[model samples]
Target: MEPLGQDEIRASFVNCTRGEAKGVTLPAPPSEIPWDRREFLGWRDPKAPARAYLVLPYGGEVIGLALRAAAPPKSRLRSNICGFCTTTHGLADITLFSARRAGKAGREGNTLGTYACGNLACSQYVRGELKPDVPQPYESLTVEERAGRLEEKLHKFVARVLESR
Candidate 1:
């Protein structure tokens, strides 16, 4: 994805600081996460960790990002499907990722999270669905091409958010 602009990043920090962060509704886990895993995942407690989150004022929607820090030591199996593409990453391909949480002032903190994709692209939660500048993936594109398309979409969404405010 295109790098978030300075202003956008700053705005994101404001949102995090203000506790305005938002997350998608998720089903309860079958078993409660263990304390060690909870700490590793940045969750203070398994019951209420802020997973499945996306930043807001970015095209008026939050995108799910499985941040790098929150990933498991090894990838694990997933029975759930991708919310974006609506296709399973397959039981084996599925992995968890942590979302980046901006901390107050100079502090950078990891807020615990577990997402299905090791990469944070939540296509189902895309904020640019009706926008003109963003591009959708096509049948013939290479991996790089698809990534570039999504990058453009993310940048455009950020710009739109800034414009609105």
Candidate 2:
């Protein structure tokens, strides 16, 4: 993935209004990110724990999506897997995130949810940069294949977010 500037990241959003894009927190500058090791840039908002974001170079352009995380349960933790990267993590490390569909569907309160890394670190997870204590579900896949699968899943999720009513 190529490094992206702040403006490029803000303009790449397809599922939210321009103002919403501007308001959400963005990842660090490209120079600060480990670009070569990342398949996509993702992060959770420091000011809003429930808010998360993901930006990726898809097709010929970058695509961004804003996600809202469900509040954590008050009871015991349970194991979960990220929908995009399919990486397994402890209960506390996984979150259920939802993205409002684009266009009129969003206005009608339509949303799509998936279990994801709580910190939005699927890139690092798939790259083995952040190892899971337990065996990953994709242990059989090569690192490259795991990254490719992550990208493929991300694209599908983004497409769903951009889909019209």
Task: Estimate every model's Cα lDDT from 0 to 1.
Answer: 0.34, 0.84
**96 in model 2: Cα distance from truth in Å?**
0.5
lDDT of 1 by residue, 1-165 (tens): 223332332244322333333232222231342322110111122344423333323344433222333434443543544322323454443345443443341144434333343333333223322222223333565544544554454444334323322
Displacement of residue 160 (Cα, Å) in model 2 is 1.2
Model 2, 11-116: lDDT tens digits are 9887789999999776676679888888888898899888888889877889888889998756575677789888778887788899988789987889998888
Clashing pairs in 2: none
Give the best candidate by lDDT: 2
Displacement of the residue 62 alpha carbon in candidate 2, Å: 1.1
Error of 2 at 85 (Å): 1.4
Candidate 2's displacement at residue 164, Å, is 0.9
- What's the TM-score of each model vs. the native? 0.30, 0.91
State the weakest 10-residue window (summed lDDT) of model 1: 35-44
**What's the lDDT for residue 60 in model 2?**
88
